[model samples]
Target chain A: MVLLLVAPAVAAGIVLLLPSARAIMRFCAMGTITTATVAACCAWRTFAGGSLQAGEWFRMDMLSAWHLVLMAGVFSAVSLYAVGYFSKELESGAFSRGKAARYAALWFGAMDAMTVVLLTDNLGVMWVGIEATTLLTAFMILTHSSPASLEAMWKYLLMCSVGVALAFIGVILAAASAESAGLTGAQVLSWTHLLDAAGSLSSAHVKMAFIFAVVGYGTKAGLAPMHSWLPDAHSQAPAPVSAMFSAFMLNAALYCVLRSLALVEAVTGSDGWGREVLLVLGLVSVLLAAVFIVGQRDIKRLLAYSSVEHIGLIAVGIGLGGAGAAAALLHAMNHSVAKTLSFMSAGRIGQAYGTNDMRRISGALHAEPLWGTGLLLGIMMLAGMAPFGIFLSEFLILKSALEGGRYLLAGALLAGLVAVFVGVMRHAIGVSWGAHEGIVRNVGAGWLDRFLVAGAILVSLVLGIWPCSRLWHVLEMASALTGGMP
Target chain B: MMPLVDSVHVLILVTCLLLLGSSRLGACIRTVAIQGIVAGGVLPWVSSLHISMQLLFTGVFVMALKGIVFPVLLSRAMREASASREMSPFVGYGTSLMAGVLFFLASLWLGAKLPTPDGVSGLAVPTACMMVSTGLFLIIARRLAVTQVIGYIVVENGIYALGLAVAHDIPVLVELGAMLDAFVAVFVMGIAIFHINREFDHMDSGRLNVLKG
Candidate 1:
């Protein structure tokens, strides 16, 4: 567990201090990410044995273990894709060697910070981890800082920082609830202590705390109404960062919400209020994403909206509980796999055409066939096409909703998803099939790039059709971490 | 006779009122500085939950960071951005002042209704609430990016005040960590503001209307 956190931070420091040799830096980054990934996977496999409790500062329970596995999964893929990404950027002279080295370092910093969030037993440190990612990724968002990227970074930093500050209020209130439970000093802010005393914590404070938590962290999670920053930041961020943001960053934010929700429900005795609120917000996010996807010109923005929709679906599933909770975990895993593929493919397609505008850059398959096909396939799965995990996951959520007697919510979710499916397919198909009028600059996707994308899609498919037995047990454990579970 | 802490709380509220109606960026910065210094006064009760030594260190440290350090960063950002004075207020002075009063009234009403835990200082909740309302209003009601950053600082102060009411004896390590993160957040934003100045001759976020949906 310690190694999983330290490897990335150490990599970041070494990457920063190295002479500006891109290959050396890339090699270092890959080595550290591989170490972290293997360690995390080991933890995940053995999680049912018991949690790895490291003092009071960090722990890896079944919940953290699974999230750690998923976070590392995305990191591994993004790290591989980044090699191809930076190679293209270097060839284009967009990243001088120094700039590339700095990029490598910041990438690791973000990875380290998020790893901390997943593993921390101290909510205060978790808040710091989340805030640090905002800062680290602010730099990453504009590796080759342009005016637009700067604007995006500015909005992201300010909005997320403010949102996170509100989350601090939630943290304080949670700790205060501990005060009522007769805990004090450091134990007040410690997750283990709070969880142990959760049943006796003040209900009013917990309820008040969660409202700010939902709004504050919800902004970070890109739940609609508070999601104004999502499209701009996601669209303008460099492609790999977009992949990280969608695949794991929002999940990190949502992870905090889950931690808070579990406590709230524990204190309030599972009265169902928390789940209902999540249901409303989740459906609203889907509806908003469906509306946004229809008119998006930027392909990255289009994928960004799809992420919002997918996250909404996951939220709804979590909201439904019982089977819904398991389904939500499965859905998050599925979405991360597919969304990473979609973003990376869009990156390549954008590179090939030198613009993200879908209308302007047509005939992607004609030029960069590998990525174009990947993009089309990614969209096919994202639109919840048959045999895809996302489809299965969404179907399970609807099934859970019906089983829970939430037919109206199930109907609304179905409608919103179908609307997005049609609109995204139309846009994706148009971009993939046509001949782009503009000059194509990027060399076609390399073997490694194609393998990563295909592997991601393959993982999603396997999870859909025949999820391994171990994975089902892991899902059960993950679902049990939340209050939504029966 | 009112306790010294009560007077300090009043000053914090007054600073918010003064900031809400004031258009001069420099004055707003100074007012925040004074508020920062005054907020140090909140820490001095002799019974002392934790070690008095640690409390003294925290008070002086917060006073220095909020009073002196942040103001320097902001003023530097203000100068580089080269727009001294707000020039335009999204919510004008007269209306903003009205909102400030309303913010106070609302905080009072809400504070009255909030469930306070046993033995908490009564003024903490209402003071924190007013600070939050004024800060959010400051963020929305301003056009310049720099002022918005200041609004964020104001919001942090409010959160800090709320932290005091609940969670007494917050771990010194976590408290310092939070403060350090706030400093870094401000520093990062300050650098970005400098770039915003370089990219466009002015830091008017209104000009940032280009990337709209």
Candidate 2:
């Protein structure tokens, strides 16, 4: 776990000193893979019941363990893809070596910051981590020297910063509520201690705190009404960075929501309030994605909406609680893997075609077979097609929703998923096989690209067909950590 | 004997209303600055421990940075951008002013409903809550980025007001860190607005909708 946190920070330092763009890319890739290995180890040990901590400041439990693994895995793949992706740009001299090196450093820095967010138990420190990620990745979003990219970066920074400020209000309120309960000093805000004393916390204040936290973190999670910045940020950012944003960063935000939900549930003794809020927000997000995905011209933006849809699903799962919480955890893992693959494939496709417009991109299978196949397969999985883990998880969410006597919510969720499926399929088919006009070969697939796509696909399929007992155990443990029935 | 804290509470409430009702961005910034200075003035009265010279210096620094320096920087940015008036907001200024009044009333209701923690006076907590919510409203209602930044400062000021009410032993380091983060965040936003203007050819976010879905 410590290695996972420190590796990127170390790599960021090394990346700054590297002489050439090639060296920088190699350093980052090596660091990412190393971090991923450490994360996998953390996940394994956490499942095996081995604990690690940095005094009281940081600790690894089943929850953080799962997130650490996912963050590192997705980052590793994206970092590898970035190497090939950025090298092509450098070779074409579209970007100077200096700019590429900066991108590498910032990418690692963002990864390091995200790891800190997942690992830290301190609420204030976690805010700092989230803010650090925003600062580091905002530059990455504007890597392209276009007005659109610059505009997107500004909107992302401004809106998210404001949202984060609101979240701080929520944190302060929670602390105040704790103080009212006689839990003074650091204990008032500590997650572990707060959870233990949650039942004693003021219900009204905690409820208000939860509302603020949800909206604040929901913005980062790309939940609708607060998700205006997402499409711009995702579409305008470099492809690998977009992949990381959709796959891992969104999950990181959801992690915060889940943490807060746990406290809210404990204090309230009923998930009804949290569930109602999440259901409304989640359904709106799905419907919004459905509306926007149909009209989306940029393929990356289309995928960004798709992210909104998947996050909505996870939110709904969490709101249901019980088995739904477990399912949500599983779905989080599956979605991160599948969505990262989808974005990476889209990035490569966009690079090859020189445009993200579906109208201009066609016959991808004929033009670039490996990337084309990756994009098609990734899209199929993302659309919740059979034989993918996403389909299984969505089914579980529906089942859980129905079992909880939320028949109306279950029906709405099903309807929304179907709408999203149709909307995404329409765009995916249009880009994959619609027409064969004006396809350019600016970049082609390499072994690393093939490896990432194949790895993501293999994991998703394997989990769908045969859930690993170990992974299930981890999910169960994570559920228990949230004070839910495992 | 009238409670001294009640006077502080009234002062903060008036300042919050001035912030909400003020049209000029310069005046709004000055109001926030005054609120910060007043907050510093109340710090010694509220604290259980004797104020050390270092703590006094820290309070002065907070007043200088948050109260004075930040607003001046925002005022300079506003002047440079040539945006003097708070443009027509999403919510009308009249509606917002009414909403601010309602928020003050709601905070009073909330404080009355809940049991106040021992040693914590009831008056300031409710007022602080109202101020915080109004500051959030200002951020959401206003259009210009600079105005929104000032709104954020007001929200933090409200939180600081609450901090004074409880008088908990938060580490000076943490307080300094929070202030530093806010300073840097505003600085970055200022730089970003300059870029937004250069790139989009306007600083008004109303026109900055190129990447929306």
Candidate 3:
């Protein structure tokens, strides 16, 4: 378990020390991330049997294990695609060797920090890990240091830091709640300890902690009204980093929320109070993203808004509990795979066009066939079109809602989904087949990119057509940890 | 003892209003510094629990970082940004001060609803809530990046006070770890401010409308 944490740091150190052959350095970085992914997968498979493992400072349970697998899968894919991304940039003289080195180093660093966030049993340490991700990736967003990139980095740092500071207070409150029941030190912030003492914990203090947890971590998760930082940071960042940010970072924050939700639910002895908060916030985020998606002009910004919507849906799924939690976890998994593909393809397309402006790009298929197809397929999948797991997960969420007799909630969610679907698919096609000449043609999507994008799409398609029963079982068990019964 | 804690809480609210009403960047940073010191000073006396080594450490760490280290870094960034005052705020100072008063009333009402634990100062929750709202107001109402950073620190101080009130048993390691994280966050933002100033030649986050919908 410790090696899972240290492997990336070790890899980053070696990558930093290696002579800067573009292929050599990237391969070394990829190799270590792959190792970490494998370790995480092993842990995931074992933990799926519902075993809980505890270290002195960290713990692995169903919730963390599920996210560990999802995060590792996304990180592995991004890293492989990143090789292609930076290679194209390098060949085109867009990135110097040193710049590429920094990207590789920080890429692994960000991965390491997120891994820590999932693994830490201590909520405060988890806050530190989230803060560390902010710092590590803030630089990643400023890889080019354009005035715009600098501004993005500034807002990302400030907003996330402030959000995270509030989260620390949440952690403190959580600790206080547990301590009022007489737990101390590590046990105060330890999830299992809090769980054990949930009944004796001050319900009001836990309630306060849970609200701050929702708002604070929700802010980091790109929840609406607090999602002001997402679009800028996502758009300004390099595509691979943007992919990681969208795919894993937000999920990690929500994973923190889920940890607190379990505590809150146990204390209250049901899912009524805190889950309502999640449901309402989830609905607001969906509506907010739907409205923004209609007026979005930047391609990355569009994808970013879509991310907010997907995150919201996942929130709603978990908030609904029972089957909804299972669906939400599945949706998180599906969104991770689909969204990474979109960002990678978008990055490729943007590089080829020298712009991310939707109006400025068209006929991407005519310019770069592989990336263009990936972009189209990825967006279609994300818009919850058929034959994609996103569609299935979303359907399950609405079904669970209707089954539970949440007609108004279901209706509002369906309406938002339809509006966003039309808007996103229209914008996606407008880029792939609309009208314009692109300058840097056909240079982006190398064979590696094609393979990775195809692999991601294939995964999404497979999950939709017939998801592995094993995967469903894992997600079900994971949801159960958060007071959901599958 | 409780009165001393109440004084600190009152002073924090005053700082919140000052920050909301002041347009001068330097004054806001200084006011945040003062808030930090007040917050740190109240820490030792406010907790009904006897001071432990962990409490002592958290006090010194927050004082050094929030009280002294952060303000110095923020002021230096202000100097480097070269803009000393917000040219025009989104919400003018007068209106923001009104918002501060309303936030105070709301916090008082909220504090009344959530029963305060015996032995803690009654004003802790209200002051913390007001400070958080004022910090958010500064972030939304001010135009300068530096002021936004100042607002962020204010918000953290508010959360810090809340932590002090409700969570004295928070492990020393977590407290120090959190303070360290906050310090590093401010440091990174300060560096970003320097870059934003140098690149755009101004500190106005309002003009950062390039990536808007």
Candidate 1's residue-wise lDDT over B70-145, tens digit each? 9999999998888888888788989999999998889888777666665555776888888888888888889998
Candidate ranking under lDDT, highest first, comes to 3, 1, 2
Q: Which stretches of candidate 2 lie over 4 Å from their true place?
A: A270-273, B1-3, B40-58, B87-95, B110-114, B166-173
Return the candidate ranking by DockQ, descending.
Answer: 1, 3, 2
Docking class of 2: acceptable
Provide the overall lDDT of each model, using Cα atoms, as 2-decimal numbers: 0.83, 0.79, 0.84
Q: What is the TM-score (0 to 1) of candidate 2?
A: 0.94
What TM-score does structure 1 among the candidates reach? 0.97
Candidate 1 regions with alpha-carbon error over 4 angstroms: B40-51
Model 1 chain A poorest ten-residue lDDT run: A20-29
Best by TM-score: 1
RMSD in angstroms between candidate 3 and the native structure over all alpha carbons:
2.1
lDDT of 2 at B130: 83
Q: What is the Cα-based lDDT of residue A266 in candidate 2?
A: 83
Clashing pairs in 2: none
**Model 2: per-residue Cα lDDT over A1-486, one tens digit each:** 667778788888888788888888888888888878878887777778655676667888888888888887888888888888888888778766688778988998888888888888766667677777777788899788788888888788877877776776667667767865677666676788788888788887678778878898899889998998999999999888999999999889878877787788888776466767887898889888888887788889988998998898888887777778778889988888888887888888888888888878988877777888888888888889979898888888889999989898888888888888888888778777755776377577777777787888899999788887877767867865554652
Compared to the true structure, candidate 3 yields what TM-score? 0.95
